[model samples]
Target: MKTFIYKKYSPRPNILHLYEHVVSIHIHEQLRKMGYYCYVDYAIKAQTHDQGLATITIEVYNSMLETEWSDLLLWNFEITDALIQIAYYQFLAEEGVLFTVKNANLKEELEVEHSNGWQTTKNIDTPKDISGKDDTALVASSKDIPLLSYDIVLNFQKKEVAKESYHDALLTLGHNIQVHLSNKKGYYRSEFSVIGNEIKLSFQVIELLSNTLGQSDSLIATGVIEELIESEALDVFIDAKKARQLNAISISTFVA
Candidate 1:
């Protein structure tokens, strides 16, 4: 199998660490839904207290079914997009920006950001003070401040690749992965390469203090093997093998 390595460095190591944890869980859950088995061999976080930087190493395993490579790449793109959305949402939530459901009519009233690229809109309407105790007071003040909402969009650009720049293509892929993963982790340095069939991904984050969050194993095994065994063809194969053994025994008894 071929292998690819993607690395990144983050200055704000703690946030980056949390982002990786969230992405790892999300990607595994997504792959499982598509009938693919993914395993994390290891995720190690090395932090330098004096330097305030943390390095993370993550190794993932897959069955390497060639037929699913395209799907894998597409999902990789989706994973990047999802991470960006989640990071933006978390940021807004942290800033006390209340986000509501997407309203079609709000686009007409407010300046909606274009969907073609990464954009964030804040305070679609007036922010309301909803922390009132009296129901009458709340109702009276509701008209003074309206509920607020926000929109975030990120788009991926398509590029043609020449045979000479295959390595560059891998680098771009690695960058995309790192950008989404780095939003919370903080930015530092990163690298990406596709070596044989195996893909190795790693990153480093700088933290103010020390942490032990990334040292634990967070892999969950899938039941693809059991599912395959329960298929109709496998049942037929098992039945046929049993019948063949019985027939051979009967022939030997007659010969005796």
Candidate 2:
């Protein structure tokens, strides 16, 4: 259904990529073995940028009616949507993955129901089902929302600035860094983390900010960098500048 779960913002594009592989390849494989077919892919078209606004989606190949499906998949009227995503939200909040979450909070009540493998708890004599990350359970969670959530929930809301300004700051970052971010694409984080309190906060020149964000997509990806610097989050990758070279716009799109 191309269900866009979140308009996530963050700085680590590469980390995000690895996460997608885990879900689409590692976790989804288990589901595939069970006979239920589904599709999972995040940051659909990154197009090489350091910062990005990636799009994450999960689609089920099943078009069967609810009556035809097991009670586990019959969640909130969705066949496979909730089944695949709930575990991920739990992971991010618990794992400290360094990103923020939004929207799904709109469906806040959608938190995990049974922690013990989603749990085998049942009493009223409804159709029996066990949910968790195990293969034996008929009602199991996809258990990959950190990737899905990471891909979809960039959490740009953490910025004190408005989203438009955040994007504008990124455009400036692109021009200065000499990289480009397609307006429709997701912005990713840098290769390093800024969470350590005493660590030398020098921005890791992962790609050598050749333009000085110069390291290709590393700087241009102003997606969802969870770290902050001097109250200006964009500085986490490269310093903010006017992006003044008029012709530079051809190489990288920016208004400053």
Candidate 3:
């Protein structure tokens, strides 16, 4: 279990709301497609068990390649790597959608990985009104995966010989060029190879008891609160092996 936290100053003077949400991403699903297929059974999940704070947890059930070192040392790093990819590729620059990992386990887990690899601002002050939905899906190129190489193919062709409408013809095809077109007086056989990523995102709502709300105090906020109060939705980016940066949240307090 882990906790995540984000805060928003309310219209009420001296009153603020700390938002909470727990998200889970199926990291292996995308990693497997990237040929990152190594790991036993395990799980990654984020939680906001406490108000104003969130935590990321990675639990490995087993592994095939057990080295002399602690199994967690290597496996945890593997998970962190995926988490970083998820953060940069999908959630960078999302205004007001900032939070942090509120657990020591994640810190200890990071010792095996990178230090402070997953960090975000403490609060968000976006537009007075916003829109969003509670959906999570794959992002092409992860919308941010650094290009590895050519992922598109384009070509051009011209007709040769009077009968075939082509007086002269030449064709070339290689690793980059897949086809050559030679037809009509002139023609173009060009297209791009998109380096698509099937990385997907999902959302989860944190339901905190509202009866404890105080006038001059702050409490854990939920999507429902944001939607009802701000008329906007929020997408929080988090990192856990199963870390999920909840997708567009519902557009009202009931849904937020």
Candidate 4:
């Protein structure tokens, strides 16, 4: 079982928060129909437009399956595409409001801007369970979609005590970031709230990697993993550009 929630805060004198409210409602409905359990519980701090805040709680309960959980995450990533479509024609939708599904690569971009370095790569392999079902097959059979790999890149501004420290930091950052992208929580302010801040990350998952990259899997999976202990077959990145280059495929194996 996973419990997800989001809190939105805006200074006084901003009516834009209302737009965030509407987007939240829109997401809630879509998530529920997708088969994962979801709902919204809000915490409002003020009555006026200028200084208001909203927080929504979304939770998912899973039993004995990791693939379903991962598929739920893929659904969350697609929600951004859904928002872009919704904000275009909704009566109350505001202009210049954009939201992006945050991913590991997004964090790498920010770290680069801030003089910190980071890298990311995606590896789509069939990790199997005792039952012998690969993640892709499992997700597809359940939701009629496929599953892919998602990994992160981390660069340091200053030499730290060890690479392990940076690795640990990236791991925590990954968990916190994945929550919002997956729509595990409510709307964070307009989509722009996500697209525009260091508080958020930038990453892209396309429906078709091959169509966009014009490269085959055999050609791209060069030098993907460096460690002997790592078992996620098909290293997706050989370096920075290599790691960031990936197609965001819809995953169905992750929903419970």
Question: Which regions of candidate 3 deviate over 4 angstroms?
Answer: 1-40, 47-52, 63-86, 92-256
lDDT score of model 4?
A: 0.27
Expressed as tens digits, the lDDT of each residue in 1-256 for candidate 2 is 2222222222333223223322323233343234332211111221112343323333333343212433232122321333333333322333334333422331222212111111222121222222122212112233422222111111122334444544544443332221112111222222222121111111212111124232333333332121112234344333444211111112222111
Compute each candidate's TM-score over C-alphas. 0.26, 0.21, 0.20, 0.22
* Full-model lDDT for every candidate: 0.29, 0.27, 0.23, 0.27
Cα TM-score of candidate 4: 0.22
lDDT for position 66 in model 1: 33
Off by over 4 Å in 2: 1-7, 38-50, 64-256
Q: Pick the candidate with the highest TM-score.
A: 1
Where does model 4 exceed 4 Å of error? 12-16, 37-51, 64-256
lDDT of 1: 0.29
Between candidates 2 and 4, the lDDT winner: 4
lDDT tens digits by residue: candidate 4, 16-78: 233343344444444434433221111112111222333344344334222343323212332
Compared with the true structure, model 1 gives a TM-score of 0.26
Model 1 regions lying over 4 Å from their true place: 39-67, 70-256
RMSD of each: 21.7, 18.7, 24.4, 21.8
| Model 3: per-residue Cα lDDT over 28-87, one tens digit each | 233223322211223434433212233344444333211221322212333344444333
- For this target, which candidate reaches the highest lDDT against the unseen true structure? 1
